[model samples]
Target chain A: MNMTFFQKFFLFFSLAIVCAGCGTDETMESQSSLDINPLSAKPSLFDQSPSNMAKESLMEYEEITGIKAVNSDKEMIIAVQIKHMKRFFMAKHRKAWQKEMEKQFPGWKVELSTDRKIYLELDKLEEKINKDTLSKDELKKEMKHIIKLSKEQT
Target chain B: MIFFWAFVVGGIICVIGQLMFDVFKLSPAHTLTILVVFGAILDGLGLYEPLIDFAGAGATVPITSFGNALVHGALQEADKHGIIGVVTGMFEVTSAGISAAIIFGVIGSLLFKPKG
Candidate 1:
């Protein structure tokens, strides 16, 4: 019944390993499923896009500034964030991205910011979406508002 | 073929984990969180998918695989809910494992006692 720290640790570690392996068998299936090409429905190692343009734009942004975009939705929202220090330089690209998105969304816009709080709201908003309390358009609007607030947060 | 690769890959990932626990002095909780977070980052970057493809279960069964599941869930949510999917997708991937852990862990604590 008596145990040392290592004994407790060993017991817990073994349990973790055993439990880790014991979970549902979907991990491999899930990963392999991504191997399916949207273009072909057949398996493929190439063409995971609709992200191609976003990737290109982000590359251009990084190439000139030597800073990478930390993240981007790039499609629905064109939501993106640069490193905190680099956010000051985001104005031109933000404007450009907004102009580009206008073709599809008209009054819709894009933004660039380094705000940390929007992420917290994003978490809550995500929950609301899951619960079905918010309409789809409302979620989109909330996201855009958050992204804009992120850009304006300085 | 898949099972062999799964064992090898899964073993190597677990070995790295064990080493971190032994040599680097990372607690099991912190190590587990780190692995999952690291995997999620890789998944977000579009890198982990290929690694998963190569390693199969070797890549997918470990803690990092949980991170991939998080990304997968989030991506699916994004499709359904728009931008917030990025936030909402956190735990859906590993929900099953988590549920099992909680249930079994509580039972073990009730039945087993550690003497100090």
Candidate 2:
């Protein structure tokens, strides 16, 4: 009573699939068991921590191209500095990074700068914003100026 | 446990991509497109949501999820606006990603000099 090789193979394959389907080890926590809808399950960027945002922005910079984000500082604007990759000299590469930054942080200025002059201003502005010395209107005025400057160079 | 499944599932997906690139000799672009289209088709059939729930980022991080997001957006819109939803829905949910890619891609082309 010899079985054909194909029949034997099919039998083993079916059994393997059945075994895989029947496993019941649910190792994940019950956090998933909570009643979470798909709509609400989507990730949101609003009201997130600033430091984490900085970290992720740097990560995104590195991911987009091979270039590292040399620096990141979040103030009125989210300033992310990319290393002076030769690619940055490419017009398309700079635009791509610029668009990439804006996409991540909409309505918030994410200036992608390689210029030393603008990079210095970005850090100084962040320092002022952190100090909280300026009044609300004054802060608003400073932000406008910073935006203008960022646009002018980068 | 969640992380474990996420790792396993994500690893499997990546392995498939690697195999296609290495063994099958498929280009990276073709592999990515195929995965995305496959995801979209699965989403249309209502099969992908369960996999997403089970694998989380394992499922979502892959290029396939881009197609899933596109189909998901369309399906959601179809419920609201009838046939017109078919067209508008494609971009509604995934515009953030698609727009960024397109805008950034164009900018990169314009700003940088390709290696000569």
Candidate 3:
């Protein structure tokens, strides 16, 4: 049927609202009987000693810079504050590094922020360094080098 | 097509907002404040989460999302700091989004002269 722009707009809007409202009900109903377990029950591979060591290194770096470091199995996020710089500086630096990373790795991302935070995806590191193929000592040395560089940057 | 629907939903919301402004003879700023407060109330009642799930970006890319952000931030802060949360919670959660909006809005306003 032919309709004015406003009429069409209102029709679509009302439909969307109704659909959204109905979808919630559907989700609740579907989830009610489902035996879904939270992922917390199973400890991740990164919960092991090497990952702990990596996290410790990040923590040490943060302690020195008066910043904070958050390490997860997948990524490491570091935050710090520097004097006499605008807040946007962090964003700019992050953007620059991200661009550089994109150029080097094509699809991989390394996020840096003006907040004195840097994030490196562990999966990307594993892929780049062939961590699975490396010997244990080689892996340790590589991780140490990475930790050193991360600390030096801040 | 998903992005298209998102824009359409956002545009429709804006239209309704404009209509409300005209019919009630309300200032845009006042309308915005009221809408945000209404969104906060809905979020407090735990109704907004469903809307977010359904509408995806449609619900999130609106000014109402800002209200949701405020409510969520406030609640999280309250959880952490108790009564002092009233002052700190909203700012902590929503500061990044709000600050960015303000900075961009200011930049846009300065760069583009709007005819009254």
- Best candidate, DockQ-wise? 2
Q: Would you list the clashing residue pairs of candidate 3?
A: A90-A113, A90-A114, A91-A114, A94-A112
Off by over 4 Å in 2: A1-154, B103-116
Give lDDT tens digits, candidate 1, residues A33-123.
2211112111222221432343345444541222112112332333344432333344555567556545533442334332336535654
| TM values, all candidates | 0.40, 0.41, 0.42
Q: Candidates' lDDT values, in order?
A: 0.56, 0.58, 0.52
What's the lDDT for candidate 2?
A: 0.58
- Candidate 3 error regions (>4 Å): A1-154, B1-5, B105-116
Residue A4 lDDT in candidate 1: 88
Please report how far candidate 2 places residue A36 from its true position, in Å: 17
Top candidate when judged by lDDT against the true structure: 2
Q: Best to worst by lDDT, what's the order? A: 2, 1, 3
**What's the DockQ for every one of the candidates?**
0.03, 0.05, 0.03
By TM-score, the candidates rank as: 3, 2, 1
What is the per-residue lDDT of model 3 for residues A48-90, given as tens digits with 9 covering 90 to 100?
3333332333333221222223233444333333221122243
Residue A8 accuracy (lDDT) in model 3: 94
